[model samples]
Target: MMKRARQDAMVENAAPQTSQENKKQKTCFYGSAFSESDPHGSIDWGSLPHHVILRIFQCLPLVDRARASSVCRRWNEVFHIPDLWRRFEFELNQPATSYLKSTHPDLIQQIIKRHADHLQYVSFKVDSSTESAEAACNILSQLVNCSIKTLGLISTAKPSFMNVSKAHFASALTVVFVNSKSLSSIKIDDTPVDDPSLKVLVANNSDTLKLLKMSSCPHVSPAGVLCVADQCHGLKELALNYYILSDELLLALSSEKHVDLEHLRIDVVSENPGQVEFHTIKKQSWDAFVKHSPKVNIVMYFFLYEDEFDAFFREETPVTHLYFGRAVSKAMLGRIGLNCPRLIELVVCANGLQPLDDELIQIAQRCKNLTAMGLGECEVTCRGFIEFVKVCGGRLTQLSIMEEVLIPDNDYSLDRLHLEVSKHLGRMWFPDMMPTWMQFDAKVTKTLQVKCGIYT
Candidate 1:
């Protein structure tokens, strides 16, 4: 009986010890589960240097980037870094159709408000609607009192949306340009704009507006442009499309007041060639037009045909940068190339094979200062490229070739042909070459992806 009592006492002691061990194990299991649920407690994010985090935030979109900044004061400070602003400018120019618009309009507005003040350029295409003016107004209002260096807007609208009154839109635009003290460039698109609106836009901003692009504004005719030329005497570049221009207007543009005009582009919508009055571009007229301006470096136009080029060349006209589509023939190219020794850039569209190899060779030989050459649909072989490269050597900085020579499939594959072509072209541009057809064909890596609906 004594031994039985001792055994019972020992069993009870062992039972309590077993229960205590079980309780300790259960606590450990729950503790491990809780630790996994909170990864910040387990992961050492503080180990990563702060600058690396800022770089990570810099790579994000403006919205996510802002969020990363708000996560901590260190990030908030880095978000305001000047280099990050440059990256933002570069990212903004990247094809805009790659982004997803924010679901929350207020969130987008806040994001825009934060960076709009820091922006040097704002390029956006808004859908044409009654809402578009309001949206544009909203965006511009944020940019008010900011130093906007460049502004480009492309608007697309349904047929019905275009019927709105100009005055109504003008009021909204006036608000946009109110305090843009440092606004330097302005590009507005195809809309029925009135002169008063334009006057208002240029009133305060004209002193600094060096570049102006006007599209589909019918009232921005030769007279209106002359007015602009008088107002913005410092204008360096002017691009116009679908504007009604006449000889009288061209005469006004030829005024000595526009001696600072360095780049000029004009495109007319009228099919009536006589309406443009080609006489305005005659040699004696151009000589008078350019007499006062010695700094005029670049002039590009889509007008003028074969006879016009011949006339201009025969008159001993000098054009520094010349671009002639299939309109001018090979003979004309040779004539002009022979005449204009100062021609530094030449762009020719191989149309109708007017400029044969011999003509191109002559131009290459004469235009000694030629720095850039663009050949589009010009039936040039490896022979032309190689010969031109040999002649131009270091002088050739930019060369664009659009045609691909297909090698025979019998003894050579497409890859080999492309490689050979690239090898030849690469030697010409050295380290600063564009991807030859071969490298573009071989590259198959995609590290980033974006999905955006096409608006334009």
Candidate 2:
């Protein structure tokens, strides 16, 4: 009788101890044990407000945010918030050479299945692999319910989209064009997007389309772009190749029904040096465009040889920003000074072995709006450069001249050239020296190689 009573007493004492241990374990916050002495020991992380948890998830990266969703049912609910999926970039890359981590296939499927309707801004960044491009297309085709507002397909290296089947690419692109009825911006450079795809885009998103950049798209003819301009009256920015830019297209854009164009970027690329002949745009057509959009910025990027510049700068051209990726001759610079009075910025990557003394002075005298200039591999005497700067006199906002471009003369030596130029410009300046490593890089020859698709 005595032993049975003692055993019952021990069992009763151990029951409450076990219950207290369970209570302490329940006080843990997200797997972290908290002591009773800590002030936040009694706090419950799962009880946090939905918006506060959402704000925390918004600052995390895509992968991290997805992993955090599995913490609890409440956190998973916050993960499904529509606002979190508004702007997202799908980094589609190959594993062999790419340093960037590719988006998980499972995550992409979840996004398409759950949050397709919430995506407003989306972009796909792919590498120079056909597999990656195909993956992007596969994902694009599955976005059947997406209401995307802005879309961009970017290639990190040489265009891989061109390597895919044109029909396949067009079919996938048409899916987005037809489905996303409210698209405002699109940048599909170096793709195989054809005329039919562009037409579908115009048909679906004519009123909402504001910016369209389709440079280096060979399949798209001049008529295709004109169709967009005729229908999409809200287009404010456009970028295309020079081959597709015709007088008729300019006229269409300058029509009263079209909105005032804000930016126009033309890439003049010559695959064959002297064999390719360029057609000229009439001054009357250019004048009409200026009348319609006076404040428009007309940017031209030239990747043509010296002989291929015959059709340009012949008559009065209203180019505001000009970039020459090849070795421009002194004669062409002189013509630019004479014909281009509205010039604001000029970048000459390479030039012939001619001292551009008179050409520089003539440009300063004529181009009153000139504010920025960059000379890379060109010859300009120290005295002539000083005289040019004196004429502009504090109006030059950015002047990037290479050290090798300035030749020492009797009037100005290397040491004294900057001092004199600084006095005229009302600020200190120095000649840009070529870095030793940059000399071996091909990018030094063409600054627009990546963005504008103008390679040397």
Candidate 3:
């Protein structure tokens, strides 16, 4: 009888302990179960679902994500997820001077070792330091097994890639060019990427290549670009310096075998303004291209001086977008108004003190498809600007006129300028007032240079 009573007491004590343990396992630290809510709280963080942890890790930066993995074994698994490694920008910079926090070398190595093959859209953004460019090249060379679809080598400032040895840079670039068979888009502006590397790119990715932007690559010649045009029949978008543009390349692109080009950007830069004479694209060649790709957008960025523009806009051209980076002459603007009928967008960085009232009116009259216009250091009377808007009417989607561009006249002062302009635009419109701080901020100026295609 004594033994039986003791056994009943032991069973009663064990039952409550088991119940408490079960409750603790069911509830989370935040008073909720992984799958559902629980009233009796708390479980450890490790009990959370794998997907939830992966999602949180996705939002974190590379460094933070790596650090977070140390918190638990489950998070470490999430860190190795292939999806997280697909699109990554390798920010290479010198640690001492760069404002941007450089990616950890160990982490880069780890990524290359484990997840290089998983990367698809990859870009290397380096600062002005040659060390950073070299580091970027080293990383590029190691991506031999990567099947990247899009690759971009961007210099934060001052074409740092130029500082890298040409042989080294080309060799490193060819590693990806040879390996990534499905590369469709590449932006390698302001680099030392030569013709041979470009040929390698065409040989490997000719079938899949769609967009190629290599403006400011001084080493590529017209023949090199022609090679690409001939081989990469599926190329839809192309951007290169004016030096590489030629009648032969245009004819090749206009060939029936080639796909209808969607966009073509040419940077007309004058290293020695008066010394360099630009060759004109024959009207016949331009006609063929226009006929072949009726809806193609031909964008031209001119960084030439006043007199160097004589060869351009002398004949009928199909240039849809025109950007003048330097101070263009009044005569040049007049010529553009006459020749450029298909003009869709125009950005004039500087046009001297002469009021462009006649030219503005002429553009509104001639360019039927004109939709966007940006004027920086230019002149236009308030009446002339309002009249120009009135002529273009609701079709003018983007009209970015600096406040100073419009000189207040008797017909319209600064106060009533917006009202009259708004009436013509069919919506409220105001002149862009440049912030005083933007004048001193180099970063902002750089951004404007990119967006507006202004040189300085």
Candidate 4:
């Protein structure tokens, strides 16, 4: 009986030991479950050096960065790093488009709310819709404190972002102009940006601004542009419509204090076809402008009626790169040969069937520096072409003349003309030939035709 009592006591002691072992087993199981459930705790990616991780994140596109943020807690934290958000492009596309994917509004808001301070360079590109414009405005308005250095607003639509009311567009843009005091490059074409907004831009960014392109902003007058010219003497390049040009503005640009301008693009728009009276700059005025900035590139795009050519080249004009949108006349081309002494590039789309023999020869003789020429729907005899090539020589770096433009006269020999021009161009050309599929065929079609007694 005494041995049985001792045995029963031993059994009770062993039961407590068993309970302790079970508790240890439960603790081990819970630890492994926690490790599996908490992915960040299990993965070693978070242990990567912060800078290395940052570079990897930087290479990912803005859209992909948002997706990677949901991967784990550590990645979510990295997504918020300021460096990743410095240069952002807010591309807005319609709901169904193949060109680009539209940015989610919620994500845009998240960026503006959390990382707007990190933005330095920004661009907004939208398709043809008011909704997209309004979305852009919303983002711009939210950038009340953004100090961006470069800003570009582009519209891929027909009506363009300018379709938005002036008041609305200016209100949003003013927010940026008022805040971004360090802006250097600003491009706002076909927007409703006016003089008041321009004043704000100049007041804020005059010292830092280097390039400005505000073409098709009708509300901006000559005085408005002049204000910018006088205030922003550091501007290297400026593009605007012709109406914004005046003697005062040109004189301001020519001032010694103003840095020698590098590029000046003028878009000549004719809204009313019947209106014959258009603005004209004097010959001496251009001479003075060129004298101050000799190396300046003067680009002119003409969108005028055939009758409107009377005032354009009445006297020697200072146009370096000239493009004709209408069917130019021989007389106008003759005037160009005499007036455009500084012409370097010329593109003519259409002229009648009458061969431009004299005009081509005159241009070849006069425009010594002409390096590039493109002709379409025009005619030039083989003799005239050969003469043009002789005068211009191999220096014509860019020559785009259609096959139809070469007229066959008494001096016509396509093979001979091709040989001469090709030798100078250092390339092969069949001046009389047009491209078709049979040119590269492997079969000996000519031999076969001869064997069958067939002639082309």
Candidate 5:
């Protein structure tokens, strides 16, 4: 007892270390001139501040953090810090019932028990197996005290192999929605996110929701989506299927109470090819949308059958970005000029034999805002191409014209066209080209670069 009292008295009487004393101590210990022993070997890691060590551990992944915590008792304490588990994603790869690529079940339970409340931005990216989905669902069901802000359930497996049906997924998600009332972004594509789960989400997170991207969810209907659009006035970005997009939907999004919408992406998917009995939005609705929110970008991606396109672009469409992955007809290309005045970027993956001469010219003349263009298996004559470029001028920044796309004749040559277009671009440019198989040696080429040496 007397010895313990003597040690306590010495500690109490010890002088507080000043900056100069600390610097001197560091120099004496670490910067001693020409030390024979290894300085790194004698370094005291325990002397480091808790915050500094925590920062170092914060930069590492969860697996690395766990491994590093085994080094000592101090680091183990730092590893268990609540701040370290605020944002996390479970990488679940299920090949069999016992297989696991991410965290083990025991580790996940520990995380839930200790740090579930700290989790703010969390996601579960799982493989296509039913086991993977079940694992993800199990983890989700355990998040009782979680206050997750952004949640994304991404299926790494193909949709065909996805056996974990919608009812189970939706049931699990309902728990997360009920808990995380401050959710701002959600991306649960191909999941069974039905109307009831959506209603629960809206009830909990309508005021805070900003972006929602659920493309190819078969269970969600137009009424369910309309409910979201009407309730979530703060929604700025949305990506959904074509069936949900309507006049009422667009007008609802353009409400005076909401801020100007930023991005509206539509996935025009086809369950059965050549299905023609599909709905299309009217032109009046688009006009009203444009008048209300002129800065909004409406990006559309088409994965439709050739016959299914007739239902789309029938009126003055407000699509700013358009991609035609299928073989588009000359009539459809022409309709793009008449209907899609707000079109800025156009990419045609494949088109029919009919030359888009007038249609190209009409697009360049009418759609003055057009900036980028890509034609893969489409034909446009040299004169028509030049006229299009002349109208677009420097604005056609991303022009990818394949060699086959330019059908040359006697009047407009590739060589002169390159020169004229280069003058407008203010820099040398080359069209993305393919080798001509038809009489390759006979094809004329364009050269934009000329070398002039000072010695010469």
Candidate 6:
């Protein structure tokens, strides 16, 4: 009798509870006339602030941001801002043509038309194949009609691999030579153009050309570069790799009135007459460089091998940046200390490095103004880094140590040698493979801010 009474009460409690739950579910799903149901996971574009949305778009890479604008009507209206697309043409690794093809081709063409008068940076990759080359030339032709201040064309194919006519590319490039009054910088690599075409390009548009680079171009000879130097008086920065830039060209640049030669990088792979190898900077060449202009502040040394660097580093000339691929011996460092007082940055990346504790200490003492340094793939242990820090404790600002150099050890128990570097927290960057240090965020934030010129 007691069991039956309990069952009746339990049934009564369960019946009201189930009915109340159903009422709540109905209210949530079908909403009452007084209140609306929340649409979870749905995006409310009208509610989001304009500036916040634009900021989010700006955070994306140039290529991504371009695509994001095409997603909807609201995005299309926001992307028309001028400041957002000023340097949009020169985004690193940005293939504008492919993105245009993926989306509405006519839409991209319209954007280009609207900004042609203000476009400044144009970067594109071209192929040696006829069809792709034609497409590239067409895109370039559109940019040529604009005020493209900087143009970089990276062709991946070997020069010998393609024997196409200069007329194929030059016919389209002629528009740039004639109309691009604001074209200041040009970088062409892995493809060599004919000398006559190069001559015509420079002859027609040399006044506005400030920087020119041609790397891995076997056909563009020393005579072609001489023509460039003779014509382009406003040339400030020039980069050439494995091409002959003759002494006559240098002399012409030196003698030119109102010449603005600031940065010159000559990477010679072949022994071309009239063009001096970086390793063989003679007294006359050094004299000519100094006499030419006081504006040339940055010079780079890119030797083909360690033997080349060994032959080159004996120069007493001053340079702001030095890049070599080997361990710098104490004696060589001593020579650099004596000669390059204004050295601001150094990069060492090679297999042959036997870093001495004393040599690094000496560098810290000598190079007071050295702000940036890159030690790429050196076989440095934690103990070696400790020694490195002991010498460059207060002054070291930027340092890159690959993960392979870290000593294998357990946590909590610091090795005697590693302790020295591990304790002093300046700005430290670690490879992703390594274990995260305790002070990772603080160090990265501090370092990135300083590197980005935002000191606080």
lDDT of 5 by residue, 1-456 (tens): 999999999999999989676545554332342213554654567656678779989888777888888889988899888888888888778556335576677779888898999999898877767777788888898888989989988777665214676777777898899998899999887877898899999999999999999988878888898899899989988999888888899888877876678888898888688654678787788887777778888888776767777887877888988876567888888889988888888877677677888999999988978987877677888878877888888887777666677877787787777776677666676665565553212121111000100000
Runs of candidate 2 exceeding 4 Å displacement: 1-44, 445-456
Candidate 6: tens digits of C-alpha lDDT, residues 1-456: 999999999888874547556455434322331122444533345345566667777788756777888877777667776656666432212253233222235645775688765667766554444444555566656754576678777554433213445666666566666667667888875554657767777867788889887766667777888888888888888777633655566677777474858877765353433344343444456557657776575555444533344444466554666664334454665566655655666665443445434545555667666665555434444554565666666565665554544454343123444345545535444432334553333344344334423222
lDDT of 4 at 323: 72
Pairs clashing in candidate 2?
none
* Global lDDT scores for all candidate models: 0.55, 0.88, 0.87, 0.79, 0.78, 0.58
The deviation in Å at residue 204 for candidate 1 is 1.2
Q: Using lDDT, give the best candidate's number.
A: 2
RMSD to native, candidate 2 = 8.4
TM-score pick, better of 4 and 6: 4
lDDT of 2 by residue, 200-244 (tens): 999999989999999999999999999999999999999999999
User: Candidates 1 and 2: which is better by TM-score?
Assistant: 2
Worst 10 residues of 2 by lDDT: 447-456
Ranking by lDDT: 2, 3, 4, 5, 6, 1
RMSD of each: 11.8, 8.4, 7.1, 13.9, 11.4, 10.5
User: TM-score of every model?
Assistant: 0.59, 0.89, 0.88, 0.81, 0.82, 0.60
Residue 171, model 5: Cα distance from true site in angstroms: 1.1
lDDT of 3 by residue, 248-326 (tens): 9999999999999999999999978688888888999999999999999999988898888878988999999988778
Which window of 10 residues has the lowest lDDT sum in candidate 1? 446-455
Q: Could you tell me which 10 consecutive residues in candidate 4 have the lowest summed lDDT?
A: 447-456
> Is 5 or 6 the stronger prediction by TM-score?
5
TM-score of 6: 0.60
Poorly placed runs, candidate 4 (over 4 Å):
1-47, 96-100, 426-456
Of 3 and 4, the candidate ahead on TM-score is 3
